[model samples]
Target: MKDIFSTIKIQVNEKIYVKDPETSALGRKIIQESILLMEEIGFDNFTFKKLGTKINSNESSIYRYFENKHKLLLYLSSWYWSWIEYKLFFATTNVDDSFEKLKKAITVVTEKIVDDKATAHINEAVLNKIIISEYTKTFHTKEVDEENKEGYFLIYKRVINRIVKLITEVNPEYPFAKSLASTIIEGSLHQHFLRDHLKTITNCDEHVSPTDFYINLIITVLKK
Candidate 1:
């Protein structure tokens, strides 16, 4: 199998269109506009026709960029992961202290989850159900294509692995480092979906900021 980084690099480098610059620009525009629409109407209600109409293009033209809604969604999901990875990498790079680095890592991940623009389009309750159903179904109902799996793992899973490694390195006695790291990461994601209820549950009258909460939680756990 191709190395994941190499594969992404190649995909990024490959020219999507060889002949028409105008067509290539239009194709990219369609995907960008579609992403914005998805952030507005959501994936279930969003359609190629609506996207084309929004962008003042014909429905047929969208096929030049995405073969179908699924493909377009896949690209959008990948883009989100890629964006998070870039932010995490940059945020953690300059921190020399292992504990500080780990805190920074959690902060970056939590902030991305709490980003307003990214979360605006989807109704949290319905979106969470769809995500859980689709993710669980992906493992069983569909064959796990190695290339796609690698691409996804690279963009998403690797970030968590790096954080876990950092946690273990900072304090080897940190019991259940792997499990705790997963908790911190996944908990932050779940918190975003349950933000309103969580605020009420925790008796925090104001919105609970994930970054501050995650950093504080990690520090408390590590000091214990």
Candidate 2:
């Protein structure tokens, strides 16, 4: 799997960028450093000028790849989901049992992410942190509806629907497969956020992980 993924390119929507960052050295540096910078600072404080400073390039050069920071965030979000979709596909592809496949799919999405050495330019661990902290900004805008029409979120929705299929396979009578699948994806992020920043509210800690909580919740909800 590692060998295969090393050769695979995680493609994002072309509309999200002026130029594909994966195509050139400077562009790849922009992506590599942006994740570190975004994780260090934040989306609000993040700017092209700062990214340019970090990468030792002109701000105009950064703009050659991304029109603005929001578009860059969209690009990053798209790439993250696309990667997760790949992991989800491989994790559950050959599992024969319906309930077990659903559990594996849940584990893939909800588990704490580790860095994958296959992709040298992009760090999955830092990118996962960025996704937890900054992913909402990608879509929580006035332009979200228009962007949705443009298929800006197709990969994200596809991830949700993949799990939705697993949910229905486990329990065909369950009418809220879509709702449950979406919640598992979105709610896992929320839980991770809470686990890190707002520890008083979330049960997930060093011992009880978000994956454990979601797996138990799924079993309780679906075992009926």
Instruction: State which candidate has the highest TM-score.
Output: 2
Cα lDDT for residue 197, model 1? 49
| lDDT for model 2 | 0.93
Candidate 1: segments with Cα more than 4 A from true spot = 1-23, 112-150, 196-207
Q: List, residue by residue over 1-224, the lDDT tens digit for candidate 1.
A: 11333224212211222222123567557655665676567666879899989989899877766666665655444444555566677678878988888877887766633332333332333433333223323233253465345453355466677788888878888778878877776676666546644455542234557667877777787864
Reference-based lDDT, each prediction? 0.58, 0.93
Please provide TM-scores, in order, for all candidate models, with all chains considered together.
Answer: 0.68, 0.99
Taking the candidates one at a time, how many backbone clashes does each contain?
0, 0
For model 2, how does the per-residue alpha-carbon lDDT over 52-170 read when each residue is reduced to its tens digit?
Answer: 89888999999999999999999989999999999999998889999999999999999999999999988999999999988989889999999999999999999999999999989
Pairs in clash, predicted candidate 1:
none
Candidate 1 scores a C-alpha RMSD against the true structure in Å of 7.4
Candidate 2 segments exceeding 4 Å error? none
